[model samples]
Target: MNEPFVRSGNRHRPLSEARARAARFAGALQDLGIGHGDRYAIVMRNEISYLEANLGAAAIGAVPVPVNWHWTGTDLEHLLTDSGSKVAVVHSDLIPAVEAHMPPGMRIVEAGVPAEIREVYGLGDVPLTGRHPVMDDLIDQTEPAVATDQAPPLAVIYTSGTTGLAKGILRDPVRPEAVPGMMRSLSDLFGLQPGYTTVLPAPLYHSAPNINMISAAALGMNIIIMPRFDAEEFLRLVDRYHVDSVQMVPTMFVRMLRLPKEVRDKYDVSSLKSVVHAAAPCPPDVKRAMIDWFGPIVKEYYGGSEGGAWVQCTTEEWLAHPGTVGKPAGGAAIRILGPDRQELPVGETGVIYGRPADYWPDFTYLNDDAKRREIDGGDGFITVGDVGRVDEDGYLYLSDRLNDMVISGGVNIYPAEIEACLLRLEGVKDAAVFGIPDPEMGESLAAHVELVPGAKVTADDVRGHVQRSLARYKVPKVVVFEERLPREDTGKLFKRRLKEKYRPAEGNA
Candidate 1:
């Protein structure tokens, strides 16, 4: 197939060209002594070459590990050493961040910063110091590597490290017989199909987008990638490309909704057939607005990097049950269990566990088998530490991560519910709720809010808003304003960072 993968702000790469480049990349890695089971890191932005590098590594049975381009210093060092990555394919601009901390003798392949990426980041077009090999030159000089029959393995996706250090989730190589089932599951969850045109606006380094891109390429879909997500530009791309589907997070929906009515009305997004969102729990109001604006195309799923199982919900299902994440996809099942590991009755809140349908592969935590054991609740059920409950109709409603729940006077408080309420208030751009020490209550809820540009809002305004919607105790005991909040590109808030900042010192009342 000669279908093209278009990178917004850059040129299109035909599938044939992409395949050839991937093969050459595989040949080059083989020349550098990379072999089966070896891991290499790709620390670049959202560019076509990022996918090419991944394909190349798979061609030779080597796994390509995608590093979050935003990581630096100790986090960067820890990932590189922990994964035992032998080579790093880095963008020209990001080399500076990796040079000081890269593992010894690690080969570096520098991808030149494309003008599009430079423009997005406001970087100047500058020459590299020639300390590392250029990716293009290597591809041009090497012949395509011979293909292997080995089943490709899943990429090692690291967790967000909210509770502690990031751990790589590794899966066994895909069984050849399981390929069809795996593809079907991915297509069902991501809305991917052959010959369809789709836009991927999230960062490629993110697990969902990375897997989606790989699936799109394999399916011969016309792929349009954005260097960075701009709310208006996304709408324009859908109209311009007649984009049929997309995968996004809730934050993108919020940003798009924040656009003026005229700006939102300017684009014709009727071409969208499937708009799937995951990675975070979307506010019910925000999701309802999107379904109204985009028709019933908006869908949602709940899963993790562990590759165990997934739960999905359609627009009609969501509208029917309003906050439910829908029922588990065919073959999958969800179980809510209390602290003692006994299954909880429907409508009772507890930890959520999932078991993959018959077709999915099992995974392990790289270098940390004990961690894997902890998540496994026996009988093939595993959880990522989320707290939620299933309704009478068997639809799941997420409360919050088990680690993020606050216990004040023996009452469990889910910050996500409060944050959702905070987002509904006018002038509130973003919010994070967590618990802090209190002498009397043992713990008290604290909120940090980011306001819309030039928005005039106060702590009392936020407290009153929450109080009107929820229990008085749910209203944050303390509210702080900020110009911005720490959020990952995928829309996950770094509440761990905020909690650490407000943690009371030992012995302090």
Candidate 2:
């Protein structure tokens, strides 16, 4: 625990150093009027300061709201305003874009862009707003505040906004006595332990990675924060650091699997003990390939930002129950409910709902209490609009989000099925399937495909490939090729953007 606990580029900071800085930051926050229960926004990529900001906010019982740096215009304004964030900690280089949208009276703290991040994104000569308080200077000038004994306030996490505007999930704060149980749940779910070296390549704005980072810090584990995800560099870091457990998403697995055999083989990833994934439904083929490559260490959990992981499966369990996300985890319960809100029998598709473990605090969508009541099953469970079924053995298998389901020609179609089939096609790097307006069928499936570099597949090739594997009705009526698909590093696709192109004009059908 005394060793350097966090690494970014060539810089390494130990947990003790981080704690001291966090305390100083807490004092600075108090001076700036951010107190217990007040929210502060963190707008940055994966970096040491991102971790520090979260820790500092938590030290004084304040909540940290991590904002996705990619958002702009209304999306950005909506989050800052909706969360009622009293302050925002932004990277100096990002000030130009963020400053314009920041709400009036919200304070700003600039975390200077590290060279590693600037280099990775190929940033050059980005100007900063010199008017804001610098994070380092604040820490230096402020006196360390006595850390609070109460458990930290739950962070205000926003949804991925794939369907619409992101909603802030404001969870109830954990009582001090409940801290140990919550920590144990987090440790078990994330495969973290004290002193275990790990690498974090996913963006910190996402819930899974953000939670992982916080838990890893609490356990005093050695941490390596990648500026951004680079398939080769990830392998190299694992080899160099002799890292143990690491969390990832299915998209990263796909990218690494696409690497040339020699390139993937060059790194000694044998040191990896656990490789965990979640955030989206992983295609079976991709999961099988990952298990084969990473040994039996590939594990997965199914949950959302609303509640902690409620279902999980180890590699062995997953192999036994191929597509299952696993039985209820950590004393949680799952139920698949049909249209009438009655629980469906095993093997029947319906909206997936779960009662999270008692250790997880209850939550409501900020400024949308009625929406929270809408999802409540009224039987002690809640759903996030996912569609799935459970096997006789009680293992859950995900189909797709309820919003993503398309009814065409009076037949229901789940885009995840077609997307998985498309991924199996040769040279297909990524694909997104969603419903689009159609006169005859009411709505037709549209597939947006991203091919591997040098791939020369035509729209016909894409459509024919789907036709060969899946039912004709599931094959997308409109096939469009793109250089790349709009997706989060966490594997959530923004299909709304793709579907917007097909929206009918106001006066026309």
Candidate 3:
């Protein structure tokens, strides 16, 4: 029986069909001179073909590089050249944007955008320009690749490049023997098991969601893919399909929580067994509200693409330790280090450095080993530049990104603390806080806020609200209201963009 399937919008394909297409695509890649450990880029929105292309490449031990669709210009060129991708499977509509950036000798395969995505994005149907081979046609013309026992190499996941240029993460291929242990750890981290049904609303380009898709397929779980995240539509899919598990980020939680009570209560979500979240720091209030709404099924994990999930907490554990992301798990080791690289006392905020469970393989930045060495904390631990500390009970609390810390007038400030406070206000919809140049103090705080529609919230109101709970210096000196703050679809705040606005003149700084 074809018990497991992958559904996107109105289209559903049995896993068997998907596997067959993947084998054909793998054969096509090999025919194009792609070899084991070679790379191919996938540049499309969430769709069935994306899955086929990714799986096809991995089937023959080739690495798939999932490029963020939002990327253009140098960011796009850099990733294509950096990954050394021999072929790029791009969406038909997105061809124009990427055509100019294609590196010399790289092949292009166009995949048509599905109706569900076209309707939502209001994208008009564009016939293929025929400048490159089509993915479906290639699959039809090629033969199925031979099966193999060797484990597939992981995708080359690039960092968000918030501080600088994007760097691709290259990991050692998993050994077939280690597959069992790694699968167990993944199942634990995601709270998923085989034969379950799961929904994925997050972008496949992100590391966690990408890994989730691969793992769910491996475990024979039915997968439902959303073209894009819509708070109400998400509920409808879960209720309609009786989805057993789902993964999300903090922003999604905020959007769902903000929905009217009547709209939220319209759909039955009792079928959900596990709801996991990570990728950004979630406010305590937001998390608590989700737990209250979704029952004790809400869970969270803490880690990065570099290490996978090293720490996680359940609903009960989070309730016991408010604001904690949870203690280390999966045989992981963690530390809070000060500027001197000395271990800090309990509850002292500092740079967080750690390694995930041994089941995960070590990785380095592609083409840049020196940068990887920079993050290596002695004794095999790697720091991802996050700032946090552990409590007396060993539960970790995230402060903010280490690069985002503001040193103003000789006092250290963590913007995440203030941003969380801003979100608690009635009218505030979103907020971003960062340091700006101040001639007298070296740096000063600036707060950019997005308010609920029709809500009358002034700059003073924002500062006053923050002052009530935080120190005087923590309050923003400059407050600006924005219709919407710059944020990634994955829910990570793009503070680097905000910082660029206040960047000092090249000669002045």
Candidate 4:
């Protein structure tokens, strides 16, 4: 069997070497009394060590909880305690920030920042603090341990926590009988196959990329990992490596489209075969432009971390149906239900629920069973609070999030519709719409926009643009310009934060 080659920036390592390190780390973990069913935390930026830590945990039948390194202070503390992490593997530079927040008796293992990472981020020669046992030293001194034959536990991924505190989604071990089918479905959805060369520009901590890299490694596909995403550099790497496929989000497409024509045309990206995008809705115009640039190879899948991929659409299918997120894949069933738990008529928007017809590994909200029960829509179908409708042919169209809908004078208004219209206007880079309290109407629409570089627009201009396309009631009562909007690395907007900022204070209305 051929070994997979994994590269991040200028650093490269074969899968064999990574496996050796993982085995040694697994030995060290075992020495520390961590094994099957145990949980550990991994807090670091994208690097080869990230994979090593994850694989090492799997070797011992332990679970690795990938924490968003961007979190710090109380947020970081909450995760360590909530997950009951026995140990923490952190990047050297991040140790100081988390040191005071970690739970008592939890061991710490520090990974030195690689030269490639420092050069890319322009952090020159910062020495390791030697505050804890170094990961490399532990790996070098410890003998490799034999891996267990037992099925490894899955990572406990946390939700985005748009409504409140994040909840961990914990899955039971995969049944051996279901492994092959699961792998086949994943391989088809992600376009992973032997000898395929893939690039993962999204953060490894994200659910999609986390699953993507593991699947790619299992399939013996050469993988390129980006420490940070740059519009032009992505195209350059694809051309340089003769990349065959990639996974990206709609924000990436917008950034690539904004690049200068000459700069975009410079790279030879014809080698790409499949480019799958998700994590958020893609505007129709943006999807059309991406198809034009990358051919019909661009595809999309819709699912949450809890449910896995349910529906998928090819560029052709999307062209035919425009905004549909594709019909169900992997024999998954989708249903739109109204407030009374009754099935809504076709084309009538309501809460979207989905589940696989075959085997889907059962999951729970770690330590929060009540939260899991709340999402259950009866008969084993579950929803993540998304509001959407199914077409006559069964393709799904997301109207907006149930939590994000605005009630103005008792009329329902979906922010996604207004945001889509805002995206079409010239000079608009990004837009977010939400509800704010209004004395007369109970609630009113408010828009926050980010403009393209060197572009100028006014609140009236934005209002007029929407007025021309949508109903006057749908137009935002207030429009505010921003230098940039808060978004996750995966292109998901932190709209809850925006909503909080605009939400009326008690007694203000």
> Model 4's lDDT to the true fold?
0.89
TM-score, each model?
0.97, 0.98, 0.98, 0.97
Residues 176-250 of candidate 3: C-alpha lDDT, one tens digit per residue: 777788899888777678888899899999999989998998898999988899999999998998888988998
10 residues in a row with least lDDT, candidate 4: 354-363
lDDT of each: 0.88, 0.89, 0.89, 0.89
What is the lDDT for 157 in model 4? Answer: 88
Encode model 2's per-residue lDDT on 1-509: one tens digit a residue.
25757999888888788888988998999999988889999999888888889889777889999999999998999999999999999998777667889889999999988888888999866555688999989999999877777666688999989989999999998866677888998887777889798899899988888989989998889989999999999999998999998999988998899899999999998988889999988888889999999899998998788978889899999999998888898888899999999989989999999988888888999999998999999766999889999998889999999999999989889999898889888888889999998889989988999998998888899889988998888878889998889998888889988888988888886
RMSD of each: 1.6, 1.3, 1.3, 1.6
* lDDT (Cα, tens digit) per residue for candidate 1, span 343-423: 999899999999987777788998999999999988989999999999999999999999989999989899999998998
Ranked candidates (lDDT, high to low): 3, 2, 4, 1
Which pairs clash in model 1? none
Q: How many residue pairs clash (N, CA or C atoms closer than 3 angstroms) in each of the candidate models, in the order given?
A: 0, 0, 0, 0
Instruction: Single out the weakest 10-residue window by summed lDDT for candidate 1.
Output: 1-10
